[model samples]
Target: MKFILASASERRIELLSRVIKDFKVIPSDFDEQTIKFNGSVPEYVMKLSKAKAEAVSSATYAFSESDVTVIGCDTIVSIDNLILGKPKDKQDAFRMIKMLSGKVHSVYTGITIINVNFDIIKCDYACTKVKFSNLSNQDIEKYLCLEEYEDKAGAYGIQGYAGVFVEAIEGCFYNVVGLPLNKLNKMFGEMGINL
Candidate 1:
């Protein structure tokens, strides 16, 4: 059996490596924009994750493989019912960071694992509340200059320079980093994957 990760996120790969010995990454090619938000963050992420897992799990090679399990994950930042995804540009990054400044936001991460041959399909999510320290415009500007906000939701990464901005986290810290490793590990254990 081959373990596969249907995501292109480096953070997920890095986090997963801490438990699993090895796995293949087959990034899901689904266009996320196809699914519009329906006012439910959990539903949005879970559906997206399921789509990604099934996309890779349905591949011919996946069926040919002794039994391939594909893992899919998706994360987003929400504050006051507004879902913030990757920033479109530097300006957008500044805007996102500014809005997130000193505010409490929720980070949601959805995890999906599927192996059609074994009739295995798992979907779950973790939500973490993160409170950011009030950031000055200069601080936001400097962080944006680092350009780490380009591909990050909320225009800040808790594992990067932006870590200083986080004053508190009420739930799983890893969830804010894009994938909740602790939660994933527990789920993997339940699935008999000894991760």
Candidate 2:
């Protein structure tokens, strides 16, 4: 069986490579904005994950009838019932960082693995509560200056310079980074796919 990752995120590919040795990265052509956020954070992520998986599984350029498993994932940061997606611009990034400075936020990542032939789909999610240290204006300014917030949810990368801002994490560190590797391994094993 072939494994395909339906995401264009370099961070996701890097994280998956740490455990799985064989897989192809075929980013889905799905439009993320088409999915609406009208429910709980988990539900929102799950819906997007399924949408992304289906988009890749049905892609015209994708492998066909070859016993393939397509994996899709989405992550969001929720704070005070607000969902913070990728920043729109530098000003948006600054606002996100300012709001998250010394507060606790939840990071939720939804994962969907689809087997096209059997129509078997597995969906799950991981959540991590992260608390940031009190950040000064300089801290936010310095992080924004690095220009790494353009594509990251919540405008910060736990694995990058933003690590300094994270004072504590209550769940999977990898979840906060983007993908929850340990939980993903367990779920993959259940589907007879060894990492």
Candidate 3:
């Protein structure tokens, strides 16, 4: 069987490598802006992930005949009712971090797995509670200098320099990193596939 990942994220690629060593990285053409938040973070992410997987699966179907499993994932950070995605600029990154300062936020990662041969699609989400310590302007400024916020949801990556900002996390650390291995294994098990 062939494995494909439907994302361009380096983080997702690295994380997925921990389980499946050989897989194709085929970033999906699905535009995230096409999906609107509908009050539920989990549902929103799941939909995004599914769209991503479908986009890649359809494209791959036309070129390959072998059995394939395509995985797609999406992550977002939420505080109160606001959803925080990747920052648009330095100012935007500062704003997101400022809002998360000294607050507990929820990081939601939605994962979708598609079995192309069987035409089966399964999707699920993992939520991890992350508490960030209070950040002064200096801290935010110093962090911004590192420029780790680029292309990362919540304007921060828990596995990077931003790790210092996080005081605690209540669920899968891998989820915050962009994929949830345990949840992923369970989802695969549901489909009678190991790994």
- Which candidate comes out best when scored by TM-score? 3
Angstrom error at residue 47, model 3: 0.3
Question: Can you list the residue pairs that collide in candidate 2?
Answer: none
Q: Write the per-residue lDDT of candidate 2 for residues 62-157, one digit (tens) a residue.
A: 444478888999999999989999999999999999999889999999999998777789999999999999999888998999998989999989
Error of 2 at 172 (Å): 0.6
The lDDT-based order of candidates, best leading, equals 3, 2, 1
**How many clashes does each candidate structure show, in the order listed?**
0, 0, 0
> What are the per-model C-alpha RMSD values against the true structure?
1.3, 1.3, 0.7
> Model 1 reaches what TM-score against the true structure?
0.95
Q: lDDT tens string, model 3, 1-195?
A: 889999988988998898898999999999999999999899999999999999999999787669999999999999997999999999999999999999999999999999998999999999999999999999999999999999888999998999999999999999999999999999999999887
Off by over 4 Å in 2: 60-62
Higher-lDDT candidate among 2 and 3?
A: 3
TM for every model, in the order presented, reads 0.95, 0.95, 0.98
The C-alpha lDDT values of all candidates are: 0.88, 0.89, 0.94
What does the lDDT come to for candidate 1?
Answer: 0.88
lDDT of 2 at 31: 92
Per-residue CA lDDT of model 1 for 1-195, tens digit only, reads: 678888888998998887777788889898899989999999998998888888888873635777777889999999999999999999999999999899999999989988667878989999999999999999999898899998898888899999999998999988988889888888777888776
